[model samples]
Target: MHLLAHRGYHAKLPENTLTAFASAVEVGFEGIETDVRVSADNEPVLFHDRVAPNGVAVAALTRKQLSEVCGYTVPTLTEALDALPGIWWNIEIKTPAAASLALPILSDYDSSHRLLVTSFRHDVVLAAAEMLASDCGLLNAHRPAALSTLLHAALPHPNLRTLVWDCEIVDPDILRQANALGFRNAVYGAKTLYEHQLMQELGVHTLITDYPQYVGLLPG
Candidate 1:
């Protein structure tokens, strides 16, 4: 199983910062998982929430403005791609606007099969599917409504490759079915070594965690 650094070694560093991402790569994580939100100019910024410093919405600020506000030097998605290389990337589109914004930037790179784009909004995945060769994940799909949407994506879209799920609420049969339909699975929040080992035994492909070094697995 591969270990993904959740928001790039956020166990100690600021989430989604370039420093955090570089540290994860240095620690030999197989992949980096980061969030994307759009600025007023439609540039994709690496941040997890709509709200920025002083209650300003991330979408309302330009790149120059949002950079100094996100608690770290908030890099644009393109900047991140430039900074980190030779590893898989799980890029989560946090808003519908970002779904559109990220695709254009992603298309500029010959990203190979290393990019897995995801979002809570299935429309975002659908939007990505229309353009990129990258695999897509059905994000946060353990809830009832989201699971319904995930089931729909699995039926016809072979590129919808993973389900980013809450580990505790998973149904093995559902995962079996999803796998049967060509979807791999990745679980979030595996806090302990035992839990990580359990996922390894479960044959899970990826586990998103804060402490990749503590999981007792070799780097992929």
Candidate 2:
């Protein structure tokens, strides 16, 4: 399985920061997964939650104010894309506006970002696919939900590419079925060695985690 740093290497730095992403790159990760939302100015920015650390809505702040309060520059999607050149991305769209706002920015990239644009909101992911040569996927908290969603998405669109599953909830059957339907799958949030070992045994090709360092040290 290919290891994707979840929100970058946040064990030693803040999640989703450029510093974290750079650390992941330096550690030799093949992929990085991050979240995106549209700012008040209609620009796509990297942010995991709608609420900021100090209880302000992330949508309520401009990019400048966001940096000030957070004590670090939270990268815009444009910035994240530029910083993470040559790595595959599983960029999760946190809202519908982000799905729309991100497409134009992504189009300027050389590789369509080597991206699998994903979202918990089905409409948002579908909308992204409608807008570009989208390698898009639906995100679910578990494998069963993702399988159900895949059944829906696969029936209508052959372009659908991946399902981002919580590592705790994934199993061999889901991967088998996903392969049968012509989509790849990725898993996230595995924090233990056993989980990583299980994922490898199941033949997972992509995994997301907070500690890419330990996972990368495992038998490949």
Candidate 3:
């Protein structure tokens, strides 16, 4: 089982900021989950939302211009790789086009040994699996009803390694079913220490949490 810092232990710093990521590593988290969106220049930047600070959509601004307006520059996918060492990355491709922008970066890192590409967009995940081929592990994010659809779409690909389930959608039966399918299951937003521990006991192999320290795996 693994404890992942959601948005890099967001309670300790701004979500998705370098400071937050570093704090997660310093606190002994093995994996960090972050989101990726493409800038106008088609550069893969680490940001979850499509809208920028000044009310402009990210699609409308060049990567350079976006950084200038947002104050904190968006870190490229490569920059994240350079910033965090030894820790595994749960990089979520937020849009269909992001697969193209992120696939090359994943290849350049070529250390698929340490990367897991995930996406809520099944098409994007499938495209990335095809693009990266056997070079990386792919994870699909799904709700209960959509799980079967995701499985049918991704099972033929050997690179699709895991399934991340929404916390509210998870049940004991589903956990067993996912395990039978040979996919590891993960839960997100275990808000407290007890909740986190209980989820681990419930056979959740990975947890994405805001309070990493509360999980008792990191220094509070």
lDDT of 2: 0.79
- The residue-by-residue lDDT of candidate 2 on 124-162, one tens digit each, is 777777765757787878556556645675456656677
- For candidate 2, the per-residue lDDT at 173 reads 86
Model 2 TM-score relative to the real fold: 0.91
- Report the lDDT tens digits of candidate 1 across residue range 1-220: 8888888977788889889999898887888999999888878889887888769998888877887665567888988888876788889988877877788888776464378888889788877876777788777745563445557755566677788877787656666766776779888878777777777777778888887667556323
How does model 3 score by TM-score? 0.87
Pick the TM-score winner: 2
lDDT of 1: 0.79
Error (Å) of candidate 2 at residue 204 is 1.3
User: Distance (Å) between predicted and true CA of 116, model 3?
Assistant: 0.9
Error of 2 at 49 (Å): 1.3
Candidates in order, TM-scores: namely 0.88, 0.91, 0.87
Of the two candidates 2 and 3, the one with more favorable lDDT, higher being better, is 2
Compared with the true structure, all predictions reach lDDT values of 0.79, 0.79, 0.75
Clashing pairs in 1: none
